[model samples]
Target: MRIGELAQRCGTTTRALRYYESLGLLTARRSANGQREYDESDLRLVAQIRSLTDIGFALEDTRPFVECLRTGHASGDACPASVAVYRRKLAELEEFIGRLTAARDRVRAQLDDAERRSRPCKR
Candidate 1:
């Protein structure tokens, strides 16, 4: 398939596909006419890349997994280093959630206080 078709199938833009190629997360062959062509395997790779990226994996972080996948590794998690990377990512996500939760609670309390102050005084 062409770049546009691949992007449409993956629910992404052609620019994103080109970016993925630049990041080494995806690959395509140039046709004689100079257009990029992709195969079914590339589609699957794009899906995996999209999922990992959505979960906050940096392009560099995802590179090893993508290489492992391309080389027919049984599982990306089977590598000890990859496991450690995921653990670190999980820890970071937890810490971010905690901070966001605290900020949200503080904002909610401020909103409640403002609401109380805006009400008319009761007898």
Candidate 2:
């Protein structure tokens, strides 16, 4: 398939596909006429890239995992360094979630207090 078809199938823009290719996360073949050609494997790779990115993994971080997958590694976690990277990412995510939860609780309390103040006082 071409870039347009791949973009439509992935529910993304052509520019995004190009960006992924540039990041070395996706691979494409050059046609005889110089247009890009993609295969089913490329589609699956794009889906993996999207999922990892949605989960807060940066492209740089994802590259090693993707390489491992492509090289038929038994498991990314088997590599000690990869495990360390994942652990770091998980810790960062936990801290971010904690901060966001605290902010949400503070906002909820403020909203509740505002609502109570807005109610008419009982005689």
Candidate 3:
């Protein structure tokens, strides 16, 4: 397929496809007519990148996953590098969750104290 078709199929923009090419995440293959061409494998690659980014992975962070796909892995997370990225992302999410939980607890405590103070006093 052509670039436009690939973008449509991936539900992405042609500009984003070009950006991916520029980032070396995708190879810009040209047909004999000098137009960009892509095969099913390219579609798979874009899908991999999209899925990763949708889950909060940075564009740069998706490189290892893309490379894994390019290396013929059945899944993008099938390589050591991709696994390392997963581990790092998991740790980051865990830390953020902990902070959020603590903040939530503090807010709950404040609300409880305020409510108690606002209650009418017993005789």
Q: What is the C-alpha RMSD of each candidate to the true structure, in Å?
A: 2.8, 3.4, 1.2
Which regions of candidate 3 are displaced past 4 Å? none
Residues 27-104, candidate 1: write the lDDT tens digits: 899999999999988877787778888988987777666676677766655566677778888999999999999999
Residue range 5-55, candidate 3, lDDT tens digits: 999999999999999999999997899999999999999899999999999
Using TM-score as the measure, the top candidate is: 3
Against the true structure, candidate 2 reaches a TM-score of 0.69
Task: Write down the lDDT of every candidate, Cα atoms only.
Answer: 0.85, 0.81, 0.96
* Worst window of 10 by summed lDDT in candidate 1: 72-81
Model 1 alpha-carbon drift over 4 Å, by segment = 74-76, 101-123
Residue-level lDDT tens digits of model 2 in 1-123: 999999999888899999988988888899999999998777766776677778888877777666665676655445655677788899998999999999999999999999999999999
Candidate 3 residue 42 C-alpha distance from true site, Å = 0.6
Number of backbone clashes in candidate 1: 0
Q: How close is every model to the real structure, measured as TM-score?
A: 0.73, 0.69, 0.93
Query: How much is the lDDT of residue 62 in candidate 3?
Result: 94
